[model samples]
Every structure is written in C-alpha cells, then in structure tokens.
Target chain A: MKAQKFWPWLIVTLGAAYFLIPLLATFIFSLRMRRNEYTFDAYVSVFSDPKFYATFGYSLSVGVFTIIVGIFVVVPAVYFVRLRMPWLRPFMEFVTLLPLVIPALVLVYGYVRLYGSSSLIPFTGSILGTDILLTCAYVMLAMPYMYRAVDNGMRTIDIGTLTEAAQIMGASQVQIIGNIILPNILVAILSGAFLTFAIVIGEFTIASLLNRPAFGPYLVGIGTNRAYEPAALAIISFIITWGAMGMINVLGRFAPRTSARTD
Target chain B: MPAFLEVQNLVKSFGTNTVVKGVNFAFAKGEFISLLGPSGCGKTTILRMIAGFERPTSGTIRVDGEDITHLKPNQRQLGMVFQAYALFPNMTVGENIAFGLKVAGMPAEQRRARVDEMLKLIGLLGFDKRYPYEMSGGQQQRVALARAIAPKPRLLLLDEPLSALDAKIRVSLREEIRAIQRDLGITTVFVTHDQEEAMSISDRIVVMNSGNIEQLGAAHDIYNRPATRFVATFVGQLNTLPAGVLAGTPGERAIRPELISLAPRPETDLTLTGTIADLHFLGSVQRLRVDIGGTLVNIDTFNNQTSPLQRGDTVTLHLAQKDLLTLGA
Candidate 1:
C-alpha cells in the first residue's frame, strides 16, 4: 500500500519537472538580454514593438470570427442531426474529424489551389476575402474539438425530451434552440471557443502560407532575427494559452450542474 | 356527446416494421386511462402518437370532437411526464414549472402564483429554488409532474413516470399523482408495464401485447374476467391448467393462484391430491408448488401463526368451479 501511494507521487513529480524545467530555463534566458546581468529588457523590447500589437490584434480578430462562424455553423448542424436527422450522425462525425486526419498544410494547399486568383471562386482576390478564407480554415481546423465538445454537452442533457418539452411549452423551433439548447451547452461552447483561441493564436503553417501577419508569423520572424526576445515571446504565448485554459475552467464552474456524467 | 378523447384505427410504422397496428380506444372527460403492457408492446408509441410526438401512418386522434392527429406537440396542449423525470437541469424547480406559462406570455405575478400552486399540489412547496440535481429521484419526478401540469393542459400523459423510483416511493408518489389528477379532474393517459401500478390508479386499464390491446375495462373487471389468455396471464399471476385435467371441457383453463387452497373447504367444488414440491414465503402469504398427477400446480395461501407447510408434505388442493377461467385456445 505504501509503495502504491509512493509510485504515483513519484511519477507525477517527475512529469512536472520534465515540462516545467525547460519553461523555467527559457524564462531565465529571456531575462539575460542586458549585457552583464539579468533584466526585463527582452520583454520590454517585445512589448514596445508595434508589430507585436498588429499581429496579436489580427490573430485576436480572426479568433473571434472563427468562433462566431464555428458556433453558428456547428450548433445548428449538430442540433438538427440529433433531433431530426439522426441517421446523418456518422457522416457528420466523419466530416468533423476530416480536419484532424487531413494535415493543416495539405488543407491550406487545397484552399490555395482552389481559391487562387485564376480559380472560379477567387477568394484570395482581396485582403478581406483572404481573411474570410483564413477564418474558414481556422473553423475547419477547430472542427473536431468544437463538435466533440458540443456533442458531448448535448448528450449530457436529454436533447429529444428537452426539445419536445420546450415545444410542448409553446416554444418555436428557433426559441427552443436559442433559449433551451444554447444555454444548456454554453459551457461546452465556451470551452471549445477557448481551445480554438489557443490553437489560432499560435498557429503558423496556414497563416504564413496565406501571407497574413498573424502572431504565429510574427513569432517566427522574431525567432529568425533575435535571440532573447524570441524566448520572451514564447513565454508570453505560453501564458496566453494558459490564460485561455484557465478561463475555460473558471467558466465551467458557472455552468449549470448536469447530473449526467459527460465523460 | 362524443367521447372526450377518441383514438380511431391509429397505426404507426417505422419503415416496414409496424409498431402500433390499427389500435383504437376512447374515454370520456376526466377519465384516467392506463395503457398497460410489457416492454416493447407499443404502449408508449400510442401515447407519443396521441401527444403528437410521432405521426401515425394512418388514422386520427380526436379530442373533444376535434381532429388533432397532425398537430404539433406544442399545439396539442398536452402535459407529459417522462420515465426519467426530464426536468431542466439548468433551471430551478419554480422556473421549470413556470416554463410553459412564461412561454405563453403570462405576466410575472401570475406565473409565480401558478408555479407556487403547482409546487403545493405536488407537496414540494419549499422546493421552488432547488435545482433537479439537488433533489431525490422522487422529488425530481414530482417537480416534473408539477412542471407538466402547470399550464393547465387539456390532457396529461405519463409514460411510465413511477418506474424509476424506489418501490416504497413509487407507491406513495403514484397515490399522490392520482389524488392530484382527481382534484384537477383533468383527462389523463398513463402508460406503464407494471400491472399493479396500472391497476391501483387507472379508471380503465388497456392491456396491450404485440401492438394490440388485449383488453380494456375497469381494473377489477380486467383482473377478474380477463378477455384473452394474454390478458389473464399478463395482468396478474395465474396457473394455467388443461381444462380436461380440472374435469372441464377440452381447452385451457386459467385460475388465480390465490383462489386455490391447501385444505378442502365447503366452498371448494373440486379437490385434487398432490404432494408439496416447494414453498416460498412471501410477506403475509405463502406460495406452494404442488405436484398433482405429474403436473405442477401453484397455490397461494395465507401465512398464519400455525406451523408452516414444508416441501414433501402430502396435501390436497381445493378449487371452486366458478374460479376456473376457461380461456379460448
């Protein structure tokens, strides 16, 4: 019994060290930007750069757009599939998982090939169109996470009975989805949104290929030219991801308690 | 006048498999009817069709002489309680009860009062602010009932509502539900696989099997004079004997286990010799299995302070001719 308890604690302590040691090293290295001693110069330099704000702002806007579009498209698709077209569930799950199975570079290549200037629907013709395309790509990339989260949420509540109950209470279809279904799955949606945000903020291959000035491209550009500032930016990116996860945890507590075990 | 709720030749088929095949029944105003059957007997399908959740492939459902077969569930104005107590986990008990009233655009004050009235009716007056997860299964089911009836629907539908509760709670809650239904005098259709639950509450019990109603009548009538072999055996415990073995015509005969006895009595018209094969002690009663002429017969007798009967004991079983139910083969 004593050995059983000791093994788990030892494994956990070792795993923590394996992840945190490199992060601690990077943080210490980032502070060595001053000539002789450790200082906050690298952080200050990265924070003061105007390019940082522009790239971060662009990524933030794209993240928001992707979330809104993802929710609008996925929620209704999943809801209808569950309520009316139950036979289409396997097909829907297959489509959502396509993002995970197909590599991001391969997907972007297809987007570029199909939507280039000479194509029938030339989405890359204007900057705004390209941004829209990029947002669509993000939505696609986050498809698996978002769909699984929302679908699991829908399962935790009795969707058919709840919808029927709501309808019996004189709610229209729109009112049922918006008022009853949406609120019940809000925590799940927010968790998906935060995960999508974390993924979009640091994503590189698609944004760089699309020629967008997203945070990923900016991070890569800084890494190529500078040393300590790159480490500082990496630490900052890690903190942002951490913050997004923390937000999900905090929002989860506020969600209505479901007696059904979602796992 | 037309019956309050009339279901005529209702048929529902999914693809090629027919679930409810040409079913028909009707009841007057304020009648409490139970569609009782074993699982997968299409009792719930009939209830759902009546509630407008499933559209019948053929036939019509008329409420107060109005054909409502094609109406949506929302427009049907029927209150339904599910087996799993489908209370909204996100809402308080009060909010759940007031959902329909709020949707109907009732004022805040009236909705609150109605919610309070419903909670009081279900005997959960102080549970308005509690969420479903915080309550016991019985309490959650009562809240679900309160929520269903809060809008004063024209009809109430309960689909095996008490099956999920404990045995003790199921009995008490069913009584409470029946009392509430009577006080409101609302027409209700309850569905259950449990015969006792159906027998104790319904004004009329519709015993169903394989998508057809075997019998429909008062509880005692259905129990005492089952119209079919399915109804006789399904509604209660019975011992089916060969009609010739009991000195009757050549057919099947059904007799209640309780109607037979261990000792010969003056009321008994026929006595059979047998040896006790097994004895089961049920509360207040003892069930004995007797081997008579190479056939096993089940007899239920009252358990008293006298010495209990044991297996391998020689016994004589008594039966009255009137108690032997001759069923059509």
Candidate 2:
C-alpha cells in the first residue's frame, strides 16, 4: 500500500506546489513595499486608491445587471426548451457555447462594428448605451453556464407535471414560472449568477476595449504600473472569486433535493 | 338530470397518430368516474382534454354548461393530481396547498386558514413547514391533491395519482382519496389502467382501448355484464370456453372464475370433468388451474375444502347457464 501510494502522493504534492508556490510568492512580494521589512503598505495603498472603489463598484453593478439580464433571458428559454421544444436542445447547446468558442475579443469587436456610432442603433454613442451594450455582452458571455445550470435544475424536478399541476390549479403561465419554476431552481440560478459575477469582475479584454472603468481594466492598469499593489489587488480578486465559490457550495447543499418526490 | 361535465365527441390526434378517436361521455354532479384503459388507449388524452391541457382535435368539453374547449388550463378551474405527485419542491406543504388560493388572490391570513383546513382534510394537519423532498411519495401525492383542490375547483382530475406509490400505500391512499372526494362532492375524473382501483372507488368506469371507449357503466355492471370482449377480458379475469358447453350455438362463451365452483349451484346442470393442473395456496382463497380436454380453466374456491386438492387430481367443476355470458358479436 505504501508503494502504491507513492506516485499519487508525489503527483498531488507537485500539483499543490504548482498552485501554492506562485500564490505564496505573490503574497511575500506584495508585503515588501516598505524595503527590507515585510509590511501591509501595498494592501493599504490599494485600499487608499479611489480608483479601486469606483471601478470595483462599477463592475459589481454591471455584474448584477448582467445576472438579471441573463436570468430573464436564459431561464425562460431553457424552460420552454426543456418543456415544449426538447428537440431544440442540441441547437440551444451549440448557440450557448458559441461565446466560449469565439473569443471575447472577437465578440466585442463584432459588437462594436454592429452598434458603432454610425450604425442605426448606435449603442456605443452614449455612456449609458455603451454600458447597456457591455452588460448585454456579458449576459451572452454567461449564457452557457446559466443555461446549463438551469437545465440541470430542471432535470431534477418534473417541470411538465409541475406546470400542469399549477395550471390546473388556476395558475397562469407567469405565475407558474415565477411561483413554481424559479423557486425550485433558485440554487441553479445562484450558481450561474455567481459565475457570471466572477466573469464580469475579472474580465479584461471586453471592458478594456469598451473603455469602461470596470475592475478588470483597472486591475490591468494598476498591474502595468505598480508591482506590490497589483499583487494585493490580485489577492483581493482571488478572495472574491473564492468567496463566490464558497457561496455556491453552501447554496448547493440546499438545492431542493429531488429526493423522495421522484419515488 | 343533465351531466355536470360532458365530453362531446372528443377527438385528439398527434400528428399522424390519432390518440383519442371520437369518444363521448358525461357524468352527473358529485360523481366519481374513472377512465380505464391500457397504455396508449387515449384515457389520459381524454382526461387532459377535460383538464384543458390537451385541446381536443375536434368536439367540445363543457363543465357546468360552459363550453371550455378553448379555455386555457388555468381558466378552466380544474384540479389535477398527476401520477408523479407534482408538488413544488421549493414550497413547504402549507405553501403548496395554498398555491392555487394565493394565485386566485386569497389574502395571507385566509390562505393560511384554508391551508390548515385542507391539510386537516388530507390528515396532514401539522406538516405545514415541511418541504416535499422530506416527505414520502404518498404524502407528496396527498399534498398534490390538497394543492389541486384548495381553490375549490369546479372539477377534479386524477391522472393515476396512486400509480407511483407502493401497493399498500396505493390502496390506503386511494381509500383516503375516495373519502376526501365524497366529502368535497367535487365531480372527479380519474384515469388509470388498474381495473381493481377503478372498480373499488369509481361510481362508473369508462373502459377504453385503442383510443376508443369499449364500455361505460357502473362498476358492478361493467364487471358482471361487459358489453364487449375487450371489456370482458380487461375489466376482470375471463375464461373463454366453447359455447357448446353452455349449449349456446357453436361460438365461444365467457365466464368469471368466481362464478364456477367445485360444489354444485342450486340448479347445477352445466358441468365439466377436469384434472387439477396447479393449485395456488392463497391465505383465504385457493386458486386451482384445471385442465379439461386440453384447455386450462382457472377457478377460485374458498380455502375451506372438504378434502384438499392437489395437482393430477380429477375434479368436477359445476356452473349454471345464467353464469355463462355470450359476449358481443
């Protein structure tokens, strides 16, 4: 047994070192702003910067809007697809994965071309319009995760029977979707929402090209100029991402067990 | 009296396949009716049409003299308990029961009171805060029934609500369902393939086959005097023997196992000589398979036999002419 465990343990140690070594180095370097002594001055500098709060707050709001748009767009489409047009599932999967297959840079360029100042809709002409465009792009970007999560949730419970039962009980379509469907799949929605939020927060290319003062562009701007504070910001982003993951695990435990109901 | 709910010449077709081929039936107020059939016999399709889930390809469904063929499922004021007990997993038992009432704009306090009353009706009085996933299949099905009926729907449709449960639970829950239906006096339409279930609880059964209703009558009538061969065989165990045995022409005749016995009837003229092929030792009943002239006939007798029967034993089976049913031509 000891000999059998040798290679597996070595591989696990190597993998752990691969991830932890850089993180440890970054933390050590981030604490070195006050030369010859380890200090939290880098963290304090990052906290002190006004750009940090503004860009973070902007990105957070954009992430929230993207989640909202994604839910409103992806959820119903998934519901209808799962219930009525199950044959369209392959097509939906292909469409949702298009964003991942085609890089974010390519997508934003296409968006700029379509919604430029000279275009009929001209979404990039105003700040609000540009923000709307960016949020819409984020929703599309997060579509694959949102759809898969909601669809997986749908698979757990019988939407067809539940919808029929609700309808037979005099619930309208909206009532069934709002009162019956959403609550059952809430964990799935949260999982997708957190993923979308993380993507929006750390995304670099789209926010950069769109000239939005989001956290991604701000982080890159800080990284190119400052070393210690950039490392601190990366650590903060890491925490935020991990925090979102923790929430997912916690919420996932309560994901409406498809338990005794199916029996 | 006119029917409280009427399905007039209902026909449903799915693309190239006709699921319900022009069927018609109706029932009085407070009637417990069952649509009984094998799978793919359009019983469920008919029930769905009545619930407004599946619109009939032709014909009309009217409840209380209202032509509800074109109405949406929600607008029809019908309560349906699905076989899978489609209770909302997110909601607790109380919320599930109060769902319809809430949708109909019932106030919170009133909804709570109503939910309690319904929970009490289903004998789940204090299970208000329990989510469905924490309950058994029977409990979830009861909650589903309560949810379907909380709004005081004009009609109740049960699409094999007990089919998903264990046999013992199915029997007990079915009794509970029948009791609740009687108390509520809601006109109910139940669909199931299990003939025993329909015969035990329903006031009338519509025996369906191949998207058509073969027979419709009271449970006793359907069981005793089936109008068609399909009905005769489907509703209960039927033994088809040569008509010459009954002294009626040259065709076949149908007989129920219960009607045949080892002991003679008061006027036992018809008789057959057969050797016991197999014997089933049921607790209170003994089922014997007797082979008479190369044809095996199943007969049920009370376990109290003067002399116990075994395989290869010669026995004489006696019956009356009235017991032999000459089924439909």
Candidate 3:
C-alpha cells in the first residue's frame, strides 16, 4: 500500500545498474590480459603503440571539430526558424529528426553517394576535402540532439520581449542575435556541444565511408589488428565521452536556474 | 488642442467574434484614467492597442497629435506593467529596473543613479542586489512598478497591477501607485476588473461591457450615475426590482448599499414594509436584508448608535430618490 517506501530505491538501483553494467563490463574486459592473469597489460599495450595515440589524437580533433561546426551551424539556424520563420518549424524539425529515423550507416552511404570522390558532387577533391566530409557527417549525425537542445532553450524565455527590448535599445538584428539571444541560451548551446562531442567521438560509419581517420574508424582499425588494445581504446573513448558529459552535468549542477530556460 | 493620447473608433475581431467593437476614448496629459470592466470585456485589448501591441482592424491612435497607430510597442515610448509582473527572472532588482535605460544606451553612472532613484521611489532602496525569486509577491510587484516608471515614458499603462496581491498589500500598493503617478504628473491608463480599485485610485473611470463603453466619467459621477443597466450592476451592488414596484424602470436600479437607509419614519418618499430576512454584523456596520413583496432589498446602517435589530422582525425600508439610478428598458 505504501508505494513510496520501496519504489524510489528500487527505481534508482535499477537505473544505476542499467548505466553501470556497460561501464563495469568494459572495465572488466580492459583488465583481462589472459584467462588467469589480471593485469594492466591491455592498457600497457594500448599506451605503448604509436598508432593508438595518433588514432586517438585524430578522434579528439575530429570530435572537437564536429562540436564547433555543429554549434556554428545549429544555433543561428534554429534561432532563425524559431523566431523569424516560425511557419516553417514543422518542416525544419522533421528534416532534422530524419537522421534519427534513418540508420547512421545508411545515412553515411547517402553522404558518400552525394559528396565522395566518385560521386556527383566529388567534394573530396578539394584541399579541405576529407576533414570537410567528416565535419559535414558529424554535423548531420549530431543535429537532432543540438537542434532539440537549442529549440527547448529558446522556448523558455520570452523571445518576443527579449528581441523587442534589444531592438528598441538600438540593437541591430545581428547584435540582438549575438549579444542578447545567444548569451541567454548559452547553457543549451553548451549542452548541445557536449552531446555533439559524445556523438562524433562514438560514430563509426561516416568516417569509414569517407575514409577519414576519425576516432571511431581508428578504434575499429585497432580492434581488428590487436584484441586487447581495442578494449583499451574503447575504454579511453568511453572515458573521454563520459568525462565530457559528466563535466557538463556537474557544471549544470551549479548553473543558474535561468540557464535551463534562457541560456 | 489635441489630447495627449487619442484612440478613434478602434475595432479588433478575433475570427468572427469582435472583442473590441468600435471603442474610442482620449486622455489628456497628467490625467489618470481607468478602464473598468469584468473579465472577457475588451479593456485589456484597448490598452494593448494603445501600447501598440495589438493592431486595430480599423482605427487610429494618435499621441500628442502624432499618429502612432502602426508603430511598434517599443517605438511608442510607453511603459506597461503586466498582471503577472513579468519581471525578468534572470536579472537582479537593479538590473530589472534599469532594463529600459540599459536599452536606451544611457551612461553607466546615470543609469545607476536612475535605478537608485526608482528603487527609493518604490521604497525598496536596499533590495537592489536581490533577484526576483528572493522577493515576496508584493516586493516583486514594487520592483516591476519601479521598472516601468524608471524610463519616465510619456504615458504609463498598468494592467491589473494590484490584483495579484493580498488585500492589505493591494490597498497600500494602489495608494503608492496613485501617489507616484501624481508626483510624476504622467498620463496614465490603468485596466482593472475591480470596481473598488478603479474608484479609489482613478480620476475618471470608463465602465465597459461587451466591447462598448457603458459609461465614462469622473469616479464619483460614474458611481453615482451609472448610465446603463449593466453599469449599475457591474460597478457596485444594486437592488433590482420591477419598475412598477422598485421606483425605477423595468431593467434595474443601481443603488449603493450605503445609500439606502432603514427607519420607521413615514416622511420618506420611497418606503416599503418587509420582514427582516437576515442580519449580518460587519464590525462597525450592520447589514439587514429586507424582503419586500418577493424582492430582497439590502440596507446598511451604523451599529454604534442603536442596538442590533434581531432577524425575523418586520421593518420599513426607506430610500432617498436621488440615490437610485433608473435605467431605460
């Protein structure tokens, strides 16, 4: 009859296990060197290899690139649609969420068909070709998360009031967007950044299709070459992603309450 | 001589139904006017139109002889306070009050001084560092008031500012608002559903119903001589009876509860015999409901000079002819 007594603890325990199991399994796999030997050999094998550092370094660069590009592309686009062209919201939202419905691998295949060297656009022939392809794919894959975050953020404040207030004060449209609107929605932008980082770092299909040396492809390459090292790489990528997200959550704890709504 | 703010034949229709139908009024400089009506009346729509938030279907709004009907809310140079206070939750009290000045690109020192002046005016000088959530409802409203008046706009519009507050705070804040408006000598238009609030604070009250102005006059005149049946009932309590029996036309008689007195005197022009249906003791005053024929008429009498009348006693109701408003059928 007293549901409150048992339900909360039960739900928390189950939720913790749901998230912790994968982490624990990864840790256990990383620790095992042999059937009987429990050592740091896998970690050692990973750290000593010259290629592991290069691959992880490439992954880090690509993830950071993806987040920066995503922020630049998404914030203004979503703000424009939400504020000026609200009539196109349903169409824009559907287009952004289309990536979620299409599998990442299938989407990457489409990107290759559209922009790869042998495809219609032949976009990879340019000087910035490979990184460009990788960045485009990352932005596409990470769009759903970023758009939703920014849209939700924009919804919290009185957009009309903020814009009107700034405009009447002699602020141009660009200044209003940059100074007032963007700063107000900084938290959402940061959350979107963190999410984009997580997605791009873990993504494998787009990089493999485009022949880009991103972290996901690098991990897979190392996995086939060295068994224990792949586990270590997986652990490293997991830590990077988890650490970034955890930092976001912790920073979010001390964030102003208005951050959830405005910035 | 043109009025400071002029609205001519304003109309606003949502879909098929018109919320504000051909309403018009004007206000001179330093005049305090109240648009008094019940909920669903077009008082707020009219206010919004004047503030340039809503575009009228057909009309013109002129401020100081300049047409501003198509201007934006910000371009009209008017400050408005919403019913919910609408204080920016992210800003401190000082920042919230200084928002207009900050927008206006005032120098920091001048802006700071103006913020301080507004805070002192609202009696919240020490609350500058506080955020909106940290303050009580009354304090938050004072901050909102300070914010609106800080800009020193040509006209100040208040939309039910005191309705959100408790009774004691509402009275005090209303008095403070009236005092500040007087001190500033700014033209003002306040919208309220509360008749008491309008009557107590406004120099003139515009009583509206179904998107039309029922009566517009000085507060005392509006209260004393309500032009229509609805105005009589809406502005104050009234005793409505058939015209033949109630001394008025068939519609209603807007009679103040305080205006009708009870006595055994036969010299009164309006007299009726009825049983005392109920008696209520309201501290200094006693309320008696007398049943005359089938209609119940209420009367208020001072309790200090006489012993309280017991319920179920037959009493004679006496009313002055000048105190009752007779409406056209």
Residues A120-230 of candidate 2 have per-residue lDDT tens digits of: 989999999999999999999888899899888888888998898888888888889998899889999999999999999998899999999999999999999997999
TM-score of each: 0.91, 0.97, 0.87
Q: Give DockQ per model, in order.
A: 0.40, 0.71, 0.26
Residue A155, model 3: lDDT of 86
- Top model by TM-score, which number? 2
> How many residue pairs clash (N, CA or C atoms closer than 3 angstroms) in each of the candidate models, in the order given?
0, 0, 5
Please give the lDDT score at residue B73 for candidate 2.
92
Each candidate's chain A: what TM-score? 0.94, 0.96, 0.85
Candidate 1 chain B weakest lDDT stretch, 10 residues: B242-251
For model 1 chain A, give the 10-residue run with minimal summed lDDT. Answer: A254-263
lDDT by candidate, in order shown: 0.90, 0.91, 0.80
Question: Please, what are the lDDT tens digits per residue for candidate 2 over residues B36-137?
Answer: 999999999898888888878999988999999999998998888998887888889998898899889999999999999999999999999999888999
DockQ winner between 1 and 3, please give it. Answer: 1
TM-score of model number 2: 0.97
Give the DockQ-based CAPRI class for model 1: acceptable
Model 3 chain A weakest lDDT span, ten residues long = A254-263
Which of the two, 1 or 2, has more DockQ? 2
TM-score of chain A of 1: 0.94
Candidates ranked by DockQ: 2, 1, 3
> Candidate 3 at B123: error in angstroms?
1.5
